[model samples]
Target: MRWARAIHHLEALAQECAVMATRPASIFPVRVVELWAVGDVLGPLRDIDAVTVALAVDLPVEEVPWLGQPRGAQQWANATRLDRNPIVGLWRSVHAPVWNHRVERPALVWDAENGVAEKTLAALHDGAGERVRLPAPGAEEWRARLTEELAVSVRALRDCTAAYEQRRWSPGKLEPVADALWRASEGYLDVLDALHGPPEPT
Candidate 1:
């Protein structure tokens, strides 16, 4: 399944990040690498959820399953015109969050990331100092545990995909597998959160 493949890619990225973190290097560089690694995995993680949702909804396999439709020229022009309007622009700038809330946002893989890359970056920075102070497990052990958990999550996703393909009309058929996948993914994210503390206040 595409979702399973994405998770596998995430596992690989996590392993790479863990190894880099363990290397004898300055803390700043190590943290930088970790932030970059998080950025790298974000794509695959998004893909995993996107594909899973597409499959769950029985979207045609031949069709590209985008979570949100691309804006057309007219839509872009309207947005540009609105931004050019000084009065509207001023109001939007003052109430950016409220204005943004009205926009359609994709259902991102990690809701904690808030579909904002800056939040993820802030998360890394917020945790970097504390992570250095925390006593972490051995690098090899950490990698092994994450790899194992990811493997199980991948397998669950694969099984769910197969079940969907075979008997899609069967109600609740994919629930167990989907639940397992969700739990496993959450566990993986929890491990990372532990390693790097929570995101800083906006």
Candidate 2:
């Protein structure tokens, strides 16, 4: 496949660079990272087309079933660190492409056969949201995983690029969403640099 070939070529290039390097080798990051974007609580997502837009923008997104009968929702987010610069993640969502487009919308979020449903999402609620089943592993764990408010803002910006892809944006209209995401990546990358520990003393 094309992707496989691309990876192979990249790996070859890295190997050669490592072999013939005069300068010391720092971390070589080629990992693919996807973004997370959620539109609203208005309705659940039934279409991957929206997600497709996210992917086309060089980031993969997941659909979580939240509103409108659990068709589309915002679910857990997990990004694994790959050698300090690259991270890879898998998104769990409320929709699947296993069936036709029609069936795709309003995707199922549960195993009907066993009558098991997700409790973190769409469950009995208590005032103040103090108690609820959030798909995130656990409350403490989720909090530990979250970077900051700015990171969330940036994630939303990554989701908003769909308008440009759909031929819907006009000069008359503002593009704050797109603008914000660009800025967010800049800040997030900074954090990456700090934690990565200063370019191997060179």
Candidate 3:
């Protein structure tokens, strides 16, 4: 009942803020359709806890003008953390990445169905709450796409490792390098799998 109530509350907030823009841009860079709570609300009771809400927004919060804060240092600082009232909780929930000196927002699959899939994936992976589940769209398609990319990356990493090992004919040096590469590649592949689901067998 708490989970349902929480969802209902978030849904109402999303609707109210859906059309409200924060000066230069909207608080939700993406047109929010889903509000993903970061943790399982139904978990074992604790004295106190914090709830984080990740939104399925149209754009990344970092790029939004009010969020980007190009004018001054104070503004930029505020933008980075998204310390504004009303939706600060949602802003902090979403992950923002930086590249080429610019904060990059999520380039989400914008399709309505994929939006649900994205939220479902996040809940499964982040919350680890199997009871909270939603059917993912294009499961087969995602599997296939990720599979091809995985194969290519794996092959390339293998070749690179082989070449690096060959460069130094000493087993003592080669063994450690090979081992490190193996572990690194495995971890990298696992991350990719987690993001898009495992690649299906050919």
Candidate 4:
């Protein structure tokens, strides 16, 4: 629950910082990826009690202080603490193919790419940590994975909505609904619409 809380906070901060980024050099570029992104799309997650979000950026560590209050607060927290620098360590961890493409706005792209990658990565690893080849994103296996993910999101939304209608609202319980709405905007809607049309008037 702490992890989810932390992620929710970070997401809020990110949205705020992104707004400020309209001014030139107001906020530096920050790439938020991995578990936190996945969590945003399908979370208030289970298992994995201890978790930390990942960020990527190129800047001198000393220049971080110039980033003023709340603009780079999370980054400051991560970099200042000796033990909280996972992103820094990741730079040295191992190599993965770097994606090469024109990003329209590098600072403001959050999409279902993270969700798609999460499914792909899960398919690529067995419970025992053995390697497996993942199905291509448009392939049958990958479609199946996305379908299942959508179903989970839909079910979660329905449950939360029903509970809210019954006046049973609770903090954090509706997070899945939020995730569903967000992921839908992030491209899950197109995927589902292509595969099965709009959800039958739930």
Candidate 5:
């Protein structure tokens, strides 16, 4: 009931209102759609990716990041463990090249004119909660589209939830509907999958 209620709540907010968002010169360069495909939220106050932190926040990868303590500083610290020591000079090589926990290269993906930066992530919203479960039109329609996609997805997942959780259906029993839901959410999930890279061998 809770999950169904949650889905219903999100579905209701599928229509969003727009607000002004300026394209700055070089921070938060990545758009919401890409971030969502990889599973992250949008907006200025939200945290960007770990790689974004290293570059935008100007934290050296070698430093003992604050570690995912609770706040941004702590999450930054968690990027480096016993592994990386990025080379400061060209022809780059680290004291321990493997120490790098950073994935994005700001130098490459940044659109300085627009203030967008590079990042790696999953397709989710940072502000995601019962209230934000519904999607709305944000800076780009992608968020709106994702909201719709999520709405449809939640409904689909609900079916499986019913059969698996409530109906107590077996594999074959839920196969048809499960396959349909998977097909529906596949496009959106692909976006998240891209940020993560290829799926592991099954």
Candidate 6:
């Protein structure tokens, strides 16, 4: 898959973030976990976006063998289960205001994130594919890399959204791509706020 490398990179980042969550002095433990969750969600999302782009450009659909299969449901289920994880639940309970402040439209964003994954996986049943083990970076390096990669993923999803819009695809087809873009953009914003702290109050 063209996005294989990016997906792997995200996984590596997520792993590092998980370790960061364990640090005694980490002030952004919840945010770190959120980043990890976002990375998990993005794996399948990137695959969906890639296939959507391929289809838009008139590429052979056969290259993706998982489309129109049931396996995607399982993949989506597995990826999203983390949202209900106890740690994430605790974050929601304890840090609701902080998260809301950092991410505008938190409910809508979360819905879009899950909705896109469900719809895309239902239609295009490809799992996250093979794992590419990457070495987790140190704190400073991982933070820098996460910012860079989040930007790249957001830009790619934006391009994918444009491809669908340009072709005048149906809402059914276009909605998922747009939702994916929205989710990715929110994830980027969340990360930025986590890294540098949220913007000062007006």
* Best prediction by lDDT: 3
Question: Per-residue error at 16 for model 5, in Å?
Answer: 36
Off by over 4 Å in 3: 1-16, 19-34, 42-49, 60-133, 136-190, 193-202
Q: Write the per-residue lDDT of candidate 2 for residues 1-202, one digit (tens) a residue.
A: 2322322322332333233222222322212122221121113322212211011111222221111111111111111111222212122221322111111112122231322223312321111111331232354433333333224334544554454445445655555444434544554454344333336665
| Cα misplacement distance, residue 115 of candidate 5 (Å) | 45
Measured by TM-score, the strongest candidate is: 6
Candidate 4 local lDDT, 38-129, one digit each (tens) = 22222323433432333333333222111111234345345335134222111100021111011001121122233223332342222211
lDDT of 6 at 185: 55
Worst 10 residues of 6 by lDDT: 50-59
- Candidate 1, residue 57: lDDT: 13
The true-versus-predicted C-alpha distance at residue 202 of model 2, in Å, is 44
> Mind giving the per-residue lDDT tens digits that candidate 6 earns over 114-178?
22223322222233322321234467765665465445445644664676577565544666555
lDDT of 2: 0.26
Question: Which is better, 3 or 5, measured by lDDT?
Answer: 3
The C-alpha stretches of model 4 lying farther than 4 A from their native spots are 1-135, 168-191, 198-202
Show the lowest summed lDDT stretch of 10 residues, model 3: 97-106
Record all residue pairs in model 3 with backbone atoms less than 3 Å apart, i.e. clashing: 29-59, 30-57, 30-58, 30-59, 31-58
Q: What is the overall TM-score of model 3 with all chains considered together? A: 0.29
What is candidate 5's lDDT per residue for 1-202, written digit by digit as tens? 1333322222221111001113331532221111111112222224333212122222222221111111132222232220132111111111212112122111211222332222211112223232322233244454443343344344545544564554345544765445444543553354334334657899
Pairwise lDDT winner, candidates 1 and 3: 3
lDDT of each: 0.30, 0.26, 0.38, 0.33, 0.27, 0.34
Predicted candidate 3 versus true structure: per-residue lDDT over 12-69, tens digit per residue: 4433433332323433233333344443432333321333344434443322211122
Clashing pairs in 4: none
**Across residues 121-202, which tens digit of lDDT does each residue of candidate 1 receive?**
3333333322222234466755564454344335544554575566556666676445444544454354445444656889
Clashes of 5: 24
* Candidate 2 ranges beyond 4 A from true positions: 1-110, 116-140, 148-153, 161-202
Assess the local accuracy of residue 191 in candidate 2 as a C-alpha lDDT between 0 and 100. 38
Runs off by more than 4 Å, candidate 6? 1-138, 167-173
